[model samples]
Target: MAHASSTHDPNVYFVPHSSKWPFFGSIALFVMMIGVASWLNEASWGKPVFFVGVALTLAVLFMWFGDVIRESVRGNYNRQVDVSFRMGMVWFIFSEVMFFAAFFGALFYARQFALPWLAGEGDGAATHSLLWQGFSSGWPNNGPAAVGGAFQTIPAWGLPLLNTLILLTSGSTVTAAHHALKAGHRKQLLLWLGITVLLGCVFLFFQAEEYIHAYRELNLTLGSGIYGSTFFMLTGFHGLHVTLGTIMLAIIWLRCLKGHFDRDNHFAFEAVAWYWHFVDVVWLALFLFVYVL
Candidate 1:
């Protein structure tokens, strides 16, 4: 769509005409998913296909978001459109909540029910003798058979604590940035937002270091059984979110530099801030349950 179809009639509810990005984006994602599945199954051509799909999807997203940025900047978006975007983001975040909930639920089930049942604690009197003879129910056990030998859990008070603090600081910085935007303090907005992005980057860096420590020094990995799997899955997905949020913050920072928002009509900034806060909250839950617990 080149421009909004509705001229000046606010009642018209402007809509883009026959957008192709959605179709292309869907195809790109399908390809990416196929590649990932193939790679996981150890296909010979899987790595190249996965990389190609990743590149294609990223390109589609870049172009698609660029179009969206252009459309928003062209004043094509009305207040109604802004409302739609807000509603969409709300549901999007809700879906993300469900996604993380499933993982956390799995962790809870493993620790509370599955482990105990297998270890003959509750109702399985003869199961432990039939299965793992001397298996003891524990929080961070590597299943009954001890898959991938023994592994050490990361210390909660070390990098995890530091990362928690970094994310908490980032949460405050992003909020301050949001307030700066609403108060029309562009300079302050940029400053706080920049710091938030920096903090996010630092968090990811520390997480990488933590992962390395887990793998090389502690003998922990995704194959170290249930504990290893959950640890990486929870922290890995959270890190991916932080990376995406950081990128969005950087883009929003640029938009701020270019004066893309006003005191009242800055739903874009608000949306990212909302997402960042959601990430912050998720990290807090992860740190508590996945680490300290």
Candidate 2:
């Protein structure tokens, strides 16, 4: 064999073997899904199974993430690894966009086609008149008057507007943190990250309060009507994404505290930033479709 190079190559991305992480992750997800489905059906042991699955999944995630962190700290990942991670994140965000698009498509279809037809428009005008006689056309609001449960529409004022501002500010804060990182201002980066996380928490708290206000005061609930269902499915999922993005940002901040990244090689932080911005965009869509319209 030819003589090997004496010096180690800094540009190579070296990753050790991880034997069972993928298998364990699959099992964890399987258990979780079984538990969720069973629990939804009121099975007796579903909750326990579900909680166990959750615990298992969390443990696996911690261990897996720990390994990655160790590898990162060891400087084993090169720019190639970072590029792969960037591509993965891009695809993941794209999938999420498509998911939200499906829901939005449903909303659009209902509004443009189904609702109009039900209101005696086009060919449906004659059929609607005979089938649902004396039924006046109006947007369904679940309350004393509507067909669904006793509920009402959530107004687009006050807390919602405040939440909009909060999320907008959060987006800015995250961007600022990214800029600080690029500038190699470590202290400023950490501070901005912390502020971004705080804003995320504040947004979550306010959203919880808003949900309570909607349920107790406005009588808006998931089971109210098509409107309520779509509203919850959109905003609720967006909120969940926000929570996840916040956790990711918090983790990145913790990594930064440990001096994990630099100006030229900070892909982890960039990935989280992309996710946060994705959450922001989804929320803007929700605000327009669910609140403004």
TM-score of 2: 0.87
Instruction: Give the alpha carbon lDDT tens digit for every residue of 259-288 in model 2.
Output: 887777778888888889888888888887
> What Cα-based lDDT does every candidate model obtain?
0.88, 0.79
Which sections of candidate 2 miss by over 4 Å? Answer: 1-16, 38-52, 140-147
Q: Which ten residues in a row have the lowest lDDT in candidate 1?
A: 1-10
| Model 1 RMSD vs true structure | 2.4
In candidate 1, the residue pairs with backbone N, CA or C atoms under 3 Å apart (3 or more residues apart, or in different chains) clash, namely none
Per residue, candidate 1 scores C-alpha lDDT tens digits across 1-293 of: 11332455666565777878889888888887888789878898887888888888888878888988888778787767777888999999999999999999999999999899989887876898787788888889889989988999998999999999999999999999989988989899999999999999999999999999999998999888899889999999999899999988998898899888878778878888899999999999999999999
Q: How far is 19's C-alpha from truth in model 2 (Å)?
A: 3.7
Cα lDDT, model 1, residue 290: 91
Sum up the clashes in candidate 2: 1
